[model samples]
Target chain A: MSILAIQNLYVSFLENTVVKNVSMDIEEKKVTAIMGPSGCGKTTVLRSVNRMHELSAHASVTGKVLLRGEDLYALDAILVRRRIGMVFQRPNPFPTMSIYDNVVAGYLLNGLRLGKPELDNLVEESLSSAALWDEVKDSLRRRGAFLSGGQQQRLCIARALAMRPEILLLDEPTSALDPKATASIEELLVQLKKTVTILLVTHNIAQASRVSDFTAFMYLGELVEFGASAKMFTAPQDKRTEEYLTGKFG
Target chain B: MTFTEAAKTLLWRQSLDKVFFGVICFFSFLSVLPLVLILGYLLVKGVSALNWQFFCRVPQPLGEIGGGIANALLGSLILLAVAFLLAVPLGLLVGIYLAENKKNWLADCARLSVEILQSVPSIVIGLVVYTWLVLPLKTFSALAGGAALALMMLPVSVRSTEETLRLIPLELKEAALALGVPYYRTILRVIVPSGLSGIVTGVLLSLARVAGETAPLLFTAFGNPFLSLALFRPIESLPHLIFYYATSPYAEWHRLAWGASFVLVVGVLFLNLTAKFLTRRWRVRF
Candidate 1:
């Protein structure tokens, strides 16, 4: 079943419309990759799902994003964000917080109280799910800034997973990492789809083909193609999708 | 040009650079010389007057010896505490507003006003506070003195807080917000903590700036001789004590003045060094 449905989504910042009349459905517990070149508005579409697009000054989003048949826009924005976690292109763990505190930051920031043992378990489970528990277990009290770039990104992932969100939105999460780190993150994404729906926006076409169960190709603020990843990669229906897949143009 | 001519020109430029470096180093030392000289002079002149009695006993009558600035010390502490309470919260809020709304017209206006307030003379602030609080209350009180100093501290704290918060990247705030934190909590919990060291440095520097101000206390505190703790009554402060004793004609009073000056200078120096240390030690790495 589809967990999220975007209907006629249009996003604009001031006078420029960036995401125009885009519509797609995100399947539950599946990796859905939004593939496009830079400035193609795939990130904008991902942000609109969690209502983060409104943070920009003069930005306006018009669309009905239904989360499990409920209108996401009609729901409280803060609650929507809580149910749909997001990670940025750059790894931004809270610099002031230690790794253990970062894992429970969602609860801490939301003013939710939990017992110590419960919190400890939550931190371990979340970190383990993000594949960072073993590496950082002994040094959980250290600041997240002390971690390497790849470790920081995993810490951010752990922080998001701690909330147990229904959907996780990633905006070019591996673009800033080295090749080995990118491979690890890609491998982790494949493992993560068993529990949470993943909506990944990537400029790298090869990355989309590698890990995504489904792919949506966007070009110049329009959704050019949406299909199963295997079918789309082998035989793209749209000329633009074929061109982008063949390295004819980004 | 010939290679020899070019080489000669290069040699001349190198000499000019060396001369410029020497000139800068000389002027830098010249600027720091006054502080060193003042500290040395105060130590030489004030050391004899500093004793256990000078710290614990009230000032003695004009011809007698063995006195202390106990009243002034306590009064200064009270006044500074009051001023810190009054200024810090309001200044931080204003600074956060200014940093968040960098392009807003009202924020621009507020920033300009803070700059102007910072440059206003301490004596003018004293006069204004006297008219506002002292004249209406019909008393020269520590409360009035505190209010005056708070006015002086506001601009410094506000500017520092704003500049410190502005140095934090927008992505940090977004990170917190993406976790479903409310806007105010994101600012208070994430943004403020990230810039905490810088904010603390700003607060300490402002406190140091007002700790030695005498003109602002002259009309408000009024320099009492007896030890009193009431906020509504006239009180003595170290700066006021130094000002009064330094102007008097007695040798004993001059000694007391030097001791008080030494104490005040040391206190200010300690605050400045603490600020510098915190800025280095507690700085958040991103």
Candidate 2:
């Protein structure tokens, strides 16, 4: 069954509609990828799901986003966002926070006090799940800013995983990382689907085809085609999707 | 060594440049000299008088020997503590509201008003407080004095806190908000802690500014020679006592005034140094 369903979504800034009448279903325990060029508003769709766009002074969203038949927009954002966590394009692991603290910042962000033992377990579990535990377990107390770029991105993923979010949104999580780190994150995402739903927004069609169970092709704020990743890449039904996949145009 | 060699004149040109740079360094040193001399003089003149008696004994009669600045010290404490209690939270809240929440006309008005208040002379502040508080209250008590000093400290704390809060990156706020933390809790837990060192520094600086002020106390505390335990009673603070005793014809009162000035300088310096030490220790954290 679909865990996340968007119906007739409309997103606008003043009079300009950026996303119009887009509808798609994200299945549970599967990685779904949205592929589009820059300015296609794929990131906007991701951000709107978690309500980060609410912070924008001019942006407004009108749509019903259902998570297991419950409207996400109508729920309190704090509760909604807890169930649906996001990792940004940039690795933002609170520069002053220690690597250990950065991993479990979601708990701290929610004001949940964990006893030392429980906190230690949470830190280990989240980092191991994000495929970063072995790399950073030794110097966990060191400042996060000292980490190399790839480690920082993995640290951000660990932070999101610490929340135990039911659904995770990655807005080009590997865009800022080197190829080695990107491959590591993509490998981790494949393993993560056993416990969580994942939605990835990216421009790399190859990455999407390799990691995603389902793929959605977006163009000019519209969902042009969406299906099983293998079928969509090999036997696309839409001419636009085929042309875009073949690099006829972005 | 002809016309071309004359223009090159290496020794002369080099000596002239060295002299010019040396003179500039000397001028910079000269600019900082007066403050250094005064601070050193205050340290030597003041610290020597900071004996246990200065904090223990009451001021003796005007002509008596071995009297202390205990009454003035206690009065300054009462005034400053109460003033800080009144000013710090209110000023910080307004500053946060201005910097984070509002950018409309009211915030603009508040900014302009604070600017005007900061530029107003301390003597003028004393005059205004005298008319506003002393007249209505019928007595220059600690409350009146504290309220006057609270006014003095508020603008300083607010301006500094606002600037510090502004210096914090917007990305931190966004990160917290994206985590599903409510905005208010995010501010209280994250934003406030992030800017805490700067806020504490601002409060300390404002406290330092308010402690040295004499004019506000002149109209509000009005200088009581005998120590009074009650906040409602008139008080003797160091600055006011200094003004009174320094102007008196008695030789003992003059010595006491210089000693009290010494005490005040040391106390304020210690507070400043303490804040600096604390902020440095906790500058980087989770």
Candidate 3:
């Protein structure tokens, strides 16, 4: 079943319309990759799902984003965001917090106090799911900034996972990592889809083919093509998708 | 074109560069000369005045050899504590607001007001506080002096907090918010702690600036003759005592004033060093 439905969405910053009339449905427990070149408004579309697009002073949005049949726009933005988590391109673990604290940051910030054992279990489960527990289990009290780049990124994923959100949105999550780190993150994302639906925006076409169950190709502020990953990649219906997939242009 | 001509010109340029480098070093040493001379003079003249009784006893008549500035020392500390309590939280909150809401009208007004308030003379602030608090309360109180110093302290504290928070990447806030953290909690728990070192440096620097200020207290604390802990009563501060004793006719008062100046300078130096130490020890590098 479709977990998120974007209906006739249009996003603008001041006078420029960035995402125009884009519509798509994201399935539950699937990795849906949105691929486009830079300035193609793919990130804007992903941000709109969580109502984070309007954080900019000039930015504005129109139309509806429905999560599980409920219109997310009608609900409080903060509450909507709580149900849908996001990970950025850069790994930004809270530098002031310890590794353990970063994992349970969501619960602490929300003032949801749990017993020591419950918090310990939550941190372990989340970090284990993100595939970072073994590397950091011995040093959970150390500051998060002491972690390596790849470890920091995993800590961020663990931070998001601890919230137990229904959906996770990633915006080019591995762009800042080296090749080996990028490969590990790609593998982790494939594993993460077993627990939560992931809608990812990536400029890396090969990454989309490798990890996504579905692919949506966007260009010039519109969704040019979207289908099952196998078909959309092998036999894209639109000429633009063909050009983008064949490396004619991004 | 000619090898010898090129070598000669290069040599000349090198000599000129050497001369310029020497000039820069000379000026750097020249700037440090006053500090070194002052410390030397204070050590020679003020050290003899410092004794065990200097820190524990109140001042006596001009002829007495063992009068101390215990009252002034305690009074200065109390006034500063009160000012810090008043200013730090208020300034930090305003700073956080300005950083978060850069486009809001209230933020703009606050930014402008901080800039303006920062430039106002310390004496003028003292006068304003006197008119505002002292006259209404019908007394010269430590509260009035603390309010004046806090008013002076607000600008530095606010500017530092704003600049420090601004330097922290926006991604940190986003990361916290993405975890379903509310705006206030994100700022209070995450952003503030991230910028802690810089904020502390600002607070320490501002405190150092106010520690030596005598003009504001001259009208407010009004110079008590003995030690008093009441915030509502008049008090003696180090700088005010120095100003009064330095201008007096007695040689004994002059010696005590020099001792107080030496102490104030040392205190300010300690604060600045602490700020530097804190920045090195605690600053987070992203």
Candidate 4:
């Protein structure tokens, strides 16, 4: 079943239309990767799903974003964000918060009161799901800023997962990590798809091919081609997708 | 190009560097000389007057012996407490507004007004408050004095809060919002806590600055010789007491003024140290 559907989604910031009339369906519990060069509006499309783009001044979005056949744009942006969580390109774990607090930040911010044992369980479960529990469980009281870059990124993912959102949008989550750290995040994403649908926007084509179930190629504010990962990698139907794949002026 | 000539030039340059270092050290010591001399004079003159009786009893009549600045001390404390209650919260809120809305017309106006208020002499503030509150109430009271001090404190606290919150990255706010936290809660929970050190330092510094101000209290609190707690009646403060006694012809009053000056200096110094300690202990580096 399709969890999210975009219908001719158009997003513009002041005078520039970054994402021009794009439509696609995201399958349930599957990883869909949007790959493009810089300035291709891949990140813009991902932000439009949860209306993250609206945070910027003078940004206006039109058309429909349907989550489970309901218009997402018609709903409250704050509530929509709660149901469809997002992780940014940079790992921004709250510097003032401890590791344990960072994991349960969403609940605390929502003023959701829980028993101590329940909170402990939630924190542990979220950390374990993000594959960071063992590495950080011993030092939960330590500040989030003390963590290494990769661990901080994983902590961010754990924070988002604590909300148990139906869909997760990641905008180049591994772009700042080392090669080894990047590999672990990619492996974690493959495992994560068993329960949550993911829409990933990436400039790294190799990362897209390695972990995605499906791939969509975007260029100059338009989605040029989309297909199964294997088919898209082996035989792209569009000439621009072929050119991008072969590194022709990307 | 001879080796001796090169050595001579090198020696000259090294001597010049030493001379510059010595000059800098001399200026540093010169800046501290006045403070050291004043503290020495105050201690020598003020210590003989210090005693348990000095702290517990109100000032006696001019011819009588053995009186303290107890009334002035209590008055200063009450005036400061009232001012703190009136100023800190409002200043912090205004600061948060200015920081959050960097480009808005309201924020710009608020910033300009705060700057203007800061530059306005404390005496002018005292006169204004005297006319505004004292005249209306028909009394020179601690409340009037406090209102003037609160005005003096507002600019510092507001500027500090705005600058501290501004230093915080926008990403932290975005991260909280992404988790579905309301904007106000995000500010209260994340931004405020993150900038706590700077905000606290701002508050303490402003409090210390206003505590020493005498002109503002001259017109507002006026002066009282006996201990009184009523906010509606005239009150005596440390600075006001010092001002009245220092300029008086009596030798006893001059001695009492020096003692009050020492006490006030110690109090202000302690507050400044606390502010410094808080910045070190609770500083959250982003």
Question: Mind giving the per-residue lDDT tens digits that candidate 3 earns over A34-96?
Answer: 999999999999999888886777888887899999999899888988999899999999998
In model 4, state the lDDT of residue A94.
89
What is the C-alpha local distance difference test score of candidate 1?
0.94
How far does residue B247 in candidate 3 sit from its true spot (Å)? 0.7
Q: What is candidate 1's lDDT per residue for A1-250, written digit by digit as tens?
A: 9999999999999999999999999999999999998899999999999999888999998878999999998988999999999998999999999999999999998899999999999999999999999999999999999898888899999999999999999999998999988998899999999999999999998899999999999999999999899999999999989888888987
Error at B187, model 3, angstroms: 0.7
> Of the candidates shown, which would achieve the greatest lDDT relative to the real structure?
1
Off by over 4 Å in 2: A95-101, A113-117, A139-143, A178-180, A203-210, A228-250, B1-20, B47-50
lDDT of 4 by residue, A113-231 (tens): 98999999999999999999999999999999988888988999999999999999999999989999899899999999998999999999999999999999999999898879999
Where does candidate 1 chain B have its weakest 10-residue lDDT segment?
Answer: B169-178
Model 2, span A107-167: residue lDDT tens: 8777889999999999999999988899889999998877877788788888888889989
lDDT of 2 by residue, B75-142 (tens): 99999988999999999998898778556888999999988998888888888888988898788889
Error of 3 at B259 (Å): 1.0
Error of 2 at A145 (Å): 4.0
lDDT of 3 at B40: 93
**Which portions of model 3 miss their true places by more than 4 Å?**
none
**Of 1 and 4, the candidate ranking higher by DockQ:** 1
Interface RMSD, one decimal, each candidate: 0.6, 2.7, 1.0, 1.1
